[model samples]
Target: MKRIMLIVSYNGANYCGWQKQNNAISIEEVINTKLKELLKEDICVIGASRTDAGVHAKGNVAVFDTETTIPPEKIAYALNARLPQDIRIQESREVRADFHPRYDKNNKKYSYRILNTKINVPIYNEYTMHASNYLDIELMKNAAQYIVGEHDFKSFCAANTGVKTTVREVYSLEITKNNNDIITIEITGNGFLYNMVRIIVGTLIQVGTGKIKPEYVAEIIAAKDRSKAGPTAKAKGLTLEEIYY
Candidate 1:
């Protein structure tokens, strides 16, 4: 058997998430079905990240074991012909037989976008979170700095996450606004807890809107209580940008 790794990208507007489910459609299920039909083998991919529903990805990774004679690099072209337009195989290649995507050491980067204007753009509605009030970008930037190092991120994670350790190291976090009044919060981390990125973005939004002081972010991190942080932002605005091995 040979292990093959695939770099997959998808617009997650219509699927439940990356993992296969019993009653719902998912990105992994769709790719697995297509691969089984192509290679005539019962194949299931192990994804690197389990992105939430309505969250998109540009460089998500997955690996599967197969015995096909097809060239590893050629699999991407053949797979794209069968995949939906929203989901495409960017690259595929063979790896060591023991390689696994999830257990490997890697850094993930994600971005959250917000449309901070009074009116919504119809074409971009599905991709961006809309906030009608004016946002102070400088204040948001100030709050993001506190999140740039190792800390206990339980305050930013969802309740009942069930993870044994909540401490995570964030390499960097940045907030920037575009000319069209779109604000983007980009973060790179060694790992993240459930809903951690969304909660961090929401807390920064609260700082920008004067609901919370910029200096209060450190206190929230120290509290390690989920209730001390702001609400979880909507999932549609978040995207998995890249993964570094």
Candidate 2:
């Protein structure tokens, strides 16, 4: 048996999440089903991350064991023909049998998009979060600095995440305004907890809207309480930008 690593990109608007679920459709389930049909074997894939519902990915990774005679690089093209339009296999390669996508990851980057306009753009409605009011971009930039270093991100994680340690290193947190109304927050980190990126976005939005001060970010992190943080931003605005191994 040979182990193959697959890098996948999917629009997560129509699926429950990345993992296979019994009651609901998922990206993983769809890919696994197609793989089983194409390869004529029962194959279970393990994903690198369990992205939330409505969250998209550009470079999500997964690995599976297969005994097929097909070449490793050809698996992506073969699988794409059978996969849905929203989900596509970006790249495939054979790796050591011991390679695991999840346990061996180095870092991940995520981005949250905000459409800060009075009227929502129809074209971007499915991908970007609409914020009607003007946001203080300077405040958001200032607030991003507090999360740049390692810290216990308990306040930014969802309740009952089951993570014993919330400490994570934020390599960079950048907020940039593309136009008058489009703002993007790009964050690179060692790892993240459940809903951590969305919660961080929400908190920064609060800072942008004057609901919270930029310095309050330190307070929130120090509090280590979820209630002290802002609400969870919509999952549609979040994307798995890339993963480094």
Q: How close is each model in CA RMSD to the real structure?
A: 0.8, 0.9
lDDT of candidate 1 at residue 20, scale 0 to 100:
85
lDDT for each candidate structure:
0.93, 0.93
What TM-score does each of the candidates earn? Answer: 0.98, 0.98
lDDT of 2 by residue, 56-152 (tens): 9999999999999999999999999998899999999999999988899679999999999989888987779999988998999999999899999
lDDT of 1 by residue, 1-245 (tens): 89999999999999999998889999999999999999999998999999989999999999999999999999999999999999999999999888877778989999999999988887778779999889998999888889899999999999998988999999999888999889999999999899999999899989999999999999999999999999999999999999998
Candidate 2 regions off by >4 Å? none
